[model samples]
Target chain A: MNKLKNTFYPLTAPKLFITDKLMRLLLMGAASTSVLVVCLIFLFLFKEAGPFAFKPGLGKLLDSQWIPVSFQQERFGVGSLLSGSALVTALAMLVTVPISVLVAIYIAEIARPGEREFLKPFIEILASIPSVVLGFFGLLVVAPLVKATFGLSTGLTALTGALLLSLMAIPTIISLSEDALVSVPYALKNASLALGASQLQTIFRVTLPAALPGIVAAVMLGIGRVIGETMAVLMVTGNAAILTASPLSSVRTMTATIAAEMGEVPFGSIHYQALFWIGIILLVITFALNIVAQRVLKKYGMMK
Target chain B: MNNTADKFILLSLRLITYAIVLVVGYILFDIIRNGFSALNWQFVSSFPRRSGAAGGIFPAIVGTFYLVVGTIAVSLPLGVGGAIYLAEYAEQNRFNSLIRLAIITLAGVPSIVFGLFGLGIFVLFFGFGPSILAGSLTLACMVLPTIIVASEESLRAVPKGFRDASLALGATKWEMIRTNVLPYSLSGMITGAILGIGRAAGETAPILLTVAAFYLPRLPKSVFDQVMALPYHLYILATQHPEAERIRHMQYGTALILLLLVLGLSLGAILLRTHSRKKFRW
Candidate 1:
């Protein structure tokens, strides 16, 4: 096809038909625009948050007192929000990751073709539902159920948020982990089975280890999602911004803090900058995980 | 012993999978139980208030519609155009690779960060303070990457022969794009736009910063007027309310409506995707 096209066009010189300069320029221009958007966002966030960088925030960040009354006494405590987010996300991941990996293993290695076909789309539907809707469901149904079972005061708690988040994260973990497990070459699993290894043993010893990097990427993506989630956490987290280790206690998250405070915060103030600082924290955490995931993916890609 | 243990493990996994499915079903059923009972024309049309729990979601419904429309208006052109340029013109090199990386990065950026960006740029700098325009623009940016990637994949799927044939017939690059490629790829582009709309409709963060009035019982008079979105309303009614009875009704009704809107949009996309997959399958 390439030869036929060249013969027909009869290119006599470098610039005869399609020029490299035009293609490269267009590609470069498009790439530059995206980078520009990213740069502009970072610059805007940092410029707004410059003052808070100098505000000596070890005490403020560490302390539980999050009272930002005015510019005079602007002591914002993000410890609770950070810990709350981490707790909820950790709980959710604890529940989701194992179940997701199990399902991935089931579908990829154990399930017959028909079952895999049937179950995969069902999981995808779960992913397609928006987060806000999930929050609403949690608030209405899961929260009440938790309250009744656990004898809690209100329906909203870290437990409810974690439950909903687990559901949301499962799809990510399952899909990606399944892709990883599926991509592991058949020969390794076959050899393990031929050598008298049980199917589960084969998966654990050979296939799982081979797919370890991709599985890590999948779990990181799940963590990235939990950290960034806003609406669901805001709805079900009780939004109290209190520091608590108890899953039953009503607490707020870093993302929830921004959502709750952004509307009320005075423009270009320390309180506002504090929110940007949260954004900075979130960016750093997720960006680091993303880079790690990228390296893992690259390693796995090279393996394949 | 090993066989029995294996059987038990498989049984437990199957049970857990079934339980997850049941959870999803339970959520939908709960929503329906509350929402369906109150979902009359009066509830749909009238304004919500303290006394009238089932009065209406008039403002919220309208607000959501405006949000979807505004987001589509802002994101569709840019997303589709960028996808076209990327798929058609760009070579697979460092430049295109950078573009891909930017898109993945954009997707991972927290929605809360976008909310902050909206607060700083749209509400503060542009002075579209706490209005629909600000909310919509923020959502537009949020959905842009999804649209770009979806449309790009579809465009890339278009065979190279079509482009070659159009060029052979003395068609300019722009003409070929306008006529040959676009016609074939219209369904894919529309699907992407619809998926973008679905995402924008359910977004709470950007709107939380941009618009998302706590009250606003009345329907928005225009884009300038403050409005209460369904998700924001649910958030308020869930957390802020002092009364438990009020909370119950509000929570259930809001949950149902939100689920309907989100599921409606998402199911539409899934159906389209499934249909397209079937149609395209040889």
Candidate 2:
């Protein structure tokens, strides 16, 4: 295009023709790495976990006691871990979903142009804050506050973990569902307004419905984060592994089980195998959640 | 009456947003303010004394720096190459969608699972042991989805006319991408990488099983040697240490340092992304 263009490296016949096959192969291999990684993770988890995962009998998994480290009798029951994870995740979602949707609506519909622009990136920064740091906040700050507020013996209960996890989850929900709310067709909201609906009604009744799939996907992704979080829950949940769902009680989550115990266990021991089994269960749960979220995101034509 | 109801709802929403923002602000402020006392010249430079009670965290800082470098080296090319194939070359089909599905699934499969995978495969099957090499490769896998998604978005953001112009000047397809497309998208790609750096640096789980050492106060001589990291250091001090009450300030300082490191990188990425968007607009 330029009258006298000077190129540092000009393409030659050998260079042009020679790289086509190599480039194609390399790029193909690069793309396939994702699939390969996922497959290998599942294979490795199952291989390490299969023998003892079934040795305890599938029915025994519901025994409400997890004594994997017992010298007297080793049992690989996952009931308490599963329930504990569920309770923490449920508490997190109860706080995350509604507030996230509200924040999304506020940013997308109510905030001024400048405010919207400022708020979106602010949410991204919030999302970028690491989980371990949040765990730190929970351990030093929120746990003490929760203890003071409720007159509990210790602050590091399931509630403290849930509260911090909710904090960690909120930004993901906000950023994603904000995209969803923004993508709802403008005409739909305008039509509601034209038919004598209030601006709030237009947003809640029309725009929110149109964006529900995307919002749901966002919530699912947030749940995925909550369920998989390790450091924060491990730090603050007290790691008692009890068979209760009370928010005020100490608990242990499956992810926490792996992170807390993996280092101390002897290699190839039943305890080690049971941790891998926890890993397998975690993988399957998260995989299911993500698949549903991906399908919803794809169906909504919302991916940018 | 209608206006009053609408106004009330809007006010409530604004309050909720305020509450959420306040929590984040509170956490950051609490960390920085309480931990500021621990940030001294000696603290950042000297080695930990008495197992992380009163001394510095130089080894942990250096280890985290090395992990970031190793992660970028391993992930940048693979992520960019894969994204380029998807955005420029791959046809839209079931197989391509399956690839997308696989990437998303991998991303959401949890860091703890990645930790296990690293322990099983890298530490055992591949015989790398609990070293920087295993941790970096595992983190490379974990960050691949973020990098690929970001790179593909930026690549797609490049104007199609530039590619056409390059091809019209008798340039081959590869040459077109090399000179015209990549230059415009480079900022976005770097932004993605910076964000990944932040995540990789602050992450505890994947490295917990792979590379992080509990009490290695000295700097690592090579990738094969285990090293202490700020995240795992903080984890140990807060949760497992017998003297958790005694060295609480050091724990806050470590948290503050990790937070600042990750937050600084993320801030750079957000700014660069804003800059890229402004520059790429027609």
Candidate 3:
């Protein structure tokens, strides 16, 4: 121990010390900078939202009215905002998770060697495409197709947003679940097969069970992506800011509401603060999902 | 219980996987056919908003380039510097762990949140007023986590022998990293930059809040001048006025160009990463 210390410890120790102290400074700067930015946003948002909270607006936040035009009758509700975001995200995850899991299964077990080679990188390429471009494609291609088939005049709707978001979430689900699936020991699979368990049975009972933690993690990650998606949802979801269960109806998600309105909403007003509150909601939801993901992974013996 | 059923299930799995591949391929092909073939010299060189049939994306392209350059300039140093500090200097402790958690949290923070933050701080507070600088700085913060993670992986990939040999040669810790560690890790560092650029190019929200001028500024003379980016231009053209035939065409043309840029960069990074892994047998 003494000899090792002598080797590392130096006479002058490079007085312009670049190691320990420099690292602390750099980390502190990066961490504080990130936290500070988010904190400031919340602070500013609440400052603006206070007036709306105290003034007793025309309607409660859960009330359906959103007319802010009349000076004597101002009303804003975020219930639809929350529901619209939730409904779209839920639909997206529903579509994305199964498809992603199947792909993960195929890659992890079913694909022939040559097929795996071709398919893996192709999926990666799909993932690397940008969200804006995805939104554009949804607008021009997917939206029009839906409108034509569904007897709608235009493409922008909850269904369009859900479809686009599903595409966005697939890569995350597939990738993380693939990691989890692969982490299932080969010995386990071999043992199951050796016991005369059919391939499908082995996968469902052993491989998948062993990989359940990872699968859950992937689902949570996809939830994060779907819930937080903005531009594509904004462009394709018709921005109607209404409550509807019908997938074809034009609606606005919480994310879309913030993005579409922030440009026109006067700063430091009730509406502006409400948008920040929406942001706060978004941050909380995603953060909770991430924590849940961590917990699920931990329970399943999956390492962080 | 039945061999036929087992074979059918296996075959169906294969078929489903193939279907996924074909769908993705068709999407790419359609993008190329509809979006790519529209690219022209006039489209590449002319400024935006010719009103009727003469719209082009010269300024949007320039705006993209400027945003990318500025973002890279800001993010690369800070990200790689932070990564080096984490990997090289920081001891495995609570504080370091907390910072790691912060980075992971930062990574999870949505792009729109980053946009809101950017809007509040850079645009409104500092009075940068939704300029390119604000857009670029916001993007810089957004991509920083990616760069840090990628570079840290690269730094970790360096063989321990290299470090031991440098130490035996009486080299200081900084000298060891500067001369040997960095050179060996340059390929990975470059790969991270490429990935970061691809991401920044596709980002729409931050640009929407920050720069994304509704009308093209004939051309930007300085960083402060508001100008349209390709994604922003595409958003406007897609959402606000699809009625304009010329603007509609410009949207497809712009989308094609932006897709090409992002796809090309992503492919290049993947290739570089693959090649490096092969070269190093990593």
Model 3 alpha-carbon miss at residue B263, Å? 0.8
Itemize residue pairs with steric clashes in candidate 2: none
A117 in model 1: Cα distance from truth in Å?
Answer: 3.7
User: What is candidate 1's CAPRI-style docking category based on DockQ?
Assistant: acceptable
Q: Measured by C-alpha RMSD in angstroms, how accurate is candidate 1?
A: 4.6
Clashing pairs for predicted structure model 1, backbone only: none
Against the reference, the lDDT scores of all candidates come to 0.79, 0.88, 0.80
Index of the highest-DockQ prediction:
2
Quantify how close model 2 is to the true structure by its C-alpha RMSD in Å.
3.0
Off by over 4 Å in 1: A1-33, A54-64, A70-74, A148-155, A193-198, A240-244, A302-304, B51-54, B160-180, B242-244
**Candidate 3: lDDT over CA atoms?**
0.80
Q: Given the true complex, what DockQ would model 3 score?
A: 0.50
Q: Candidate 1's error at A264, in angstroms?
A: 2.2
Compute each candidate's TM-score over C-alphas: 0.88, 0.96, 0.92
Candidate 3 C-alpha lDDT tens digits along A115-149: 78888888777777778878888887899998999
| lDDT by residue (tens digit), candidate 1, A1-304 | 9987887666543443354346445544644555566665677778777787677654566667566675566668778888899999998998999899988888888778997887887776677676877887787678999999999889799989999999899988998999999998889999999999987789889999999889999999889988999989888988887878999999889998888777777788778888888888887787678767877898769222
User: What are the runs in model 3 whose C-alpha is more than 4 Å off?
Assistant: A1-60, A70-72, B51-53, B242-247
Model 2 has a DockQ score of: 0.80
Docking class of 3: medium
